[model samples]
Target: MIYNLTYNGIIKVSREHLSNKLEVGFNTISTAFKYMEQSKLFILSRNRSGKTNCGYRVILDMQHVNFESILSEVYHLKAYEIAIVKDEFKQPNKYQDLAQNAYISTLNGSNSTLNYNNQI
Candidate 1:
């Protein structure tokens, strides 16, 4: 929902607006928005009427990763390159293979290994 709202630019989304769009309860939407706000993923503001309005501001763009469309844009990049970059930035010392193995092992009951000698 945040992704959709912030896709093009900052969007002011109220709790009622999100609840109506997602077909969920008002408290559920508010809680989710609060979680995202606390995580610094979005900025929440209050209007003169004291209603909630959330946005991913231009300066506060840590919410970029929430956009599925952005990920789809990068899907054509080589998998190894993606893994290497993610490992280097997000998980130091862990190669793509090791990361894949660990992730798969968590879900599939099989271990994955890293080819430490290979440079992705």
Candidate 2:
């Protein structure tokens, strides 16, 4: 239920709302959520509006250290690194001359004045 609800972009969900769909009492759902938290399977937050009013939001934790989690972290890191490298090396076909000139200028000297002027 949580997976289905969160598969879209809804990060926050209530315990009562979950319980109603599952056809269980609020306490039972709350207890199961508490167990999941204690086992480090997921993270849970209080409703903050007391027991009668609000629903708890569930957040999936990234520190589980499982193979799937490790793979996910590695995949994300590699993707971002590739994107950064791509952005750093990007040059328009029409502006290739300008890009090459800039690259050559940087390679020609470590000009502190030019670097400072560019930053300013």
Candidate 3:
């Protein structure tokens, strides 16, 4: 959802709007936004002055973002570290393979290792 919204570069939208669009509760969206902000995926600013009902301002710098870090930080999934290692190989084309292997390993409750040469 945040990825899709990146096309706008920076967006100002209410938590209620995001909740309605994602079909989730407002508090959930709010918490997710806090996580996202803490993860450095984006900058979140609120209308704290209370003068107006304007929404949050989200500033995204997609170019320098490490999405795997965001996933690990925000979702608290250590398995995404495999994705970070895969990224270190500079093999963007094999990202899907590594991700799938990581998921499969998690599902099978095994700790599969990857070689430095990018082999699973």
Candidate 4:
């Protein structure tokens, strides 16, 4: 949903809007937004007066994400399996950069770590 919104150049959003679109409660959307912000996937800012919407800048740069580690840690996938899946991609370099950035982001302390390796 966020990716779609970002793709459409819609950065500003409200909890109510998301709630209605996702068919979820407002607080659930708020929590999800907060989690995304903490994950560095979104930059959230408070709106000015008379506005209920919040400014959300979705971070779509693949270089900043670590798909390998995320899949391994979060989804319990093996490195070899990840390698196989990555090989299926037409442009595997993109995934390689994402793996590298995971190491970079961890060293830079920009992302939460879950047993990330020191070597890239």
Q: Which candidate is the best by lDDT?
A: 3
Winner by lDDT between candidate 4 and candidate 1: 4
Cand. 4 Cα-lDDT: 0.54
Window of ten residues with lowest summed lDDT in model 3: 99-108
Clashing pairs in 1: 101-112
For residues 24-94, could you state the per-residue lDDT of candidate 4 as single tens digits? 99789878876665454333555455574544433321222555664476447798887875565434333
Candidate 4 — which residues are off by over 4 angstroms? 5-10, 50-120
The Cα error of candidate 1 at residue 41, in Å, is 2.3
Clashes of each: 1, 0, 0, 0
Q: Give the TM-score of candidate 3.
A: 0.44
User: Can you write out model 2's per-residue Cα lDDT over 28-97, one digit (the tens) per residue?
Assistant: 9778867655544344555456656754674554233342343345334465664563454343345334
Question: By the lDDT metric, which is better: model 1 or model 2?
Answer: 2
Candidate 4 vs. true structure, TM-score: 0.38
If scored against the real structure, what TM-score would every candidate get? 0.39, 0.38, 0.44, 0.38
For candidate 3, give the lDDT of residue 74. 43
In model 3, which runs have C-alpha deviations exceeding 4 angstroms? 47-54, 62-120
Q: Please give the CA lDDT of all the candidate structures.
A: 0.48, 0.50, 0.56, 0.54
What order do candidates take by TM-score, descending?
Answer: 3, 1, 4, 2
Against the true structure, what is every candidate's RMSD?
13.1, 19.7, 13.5, 15.8
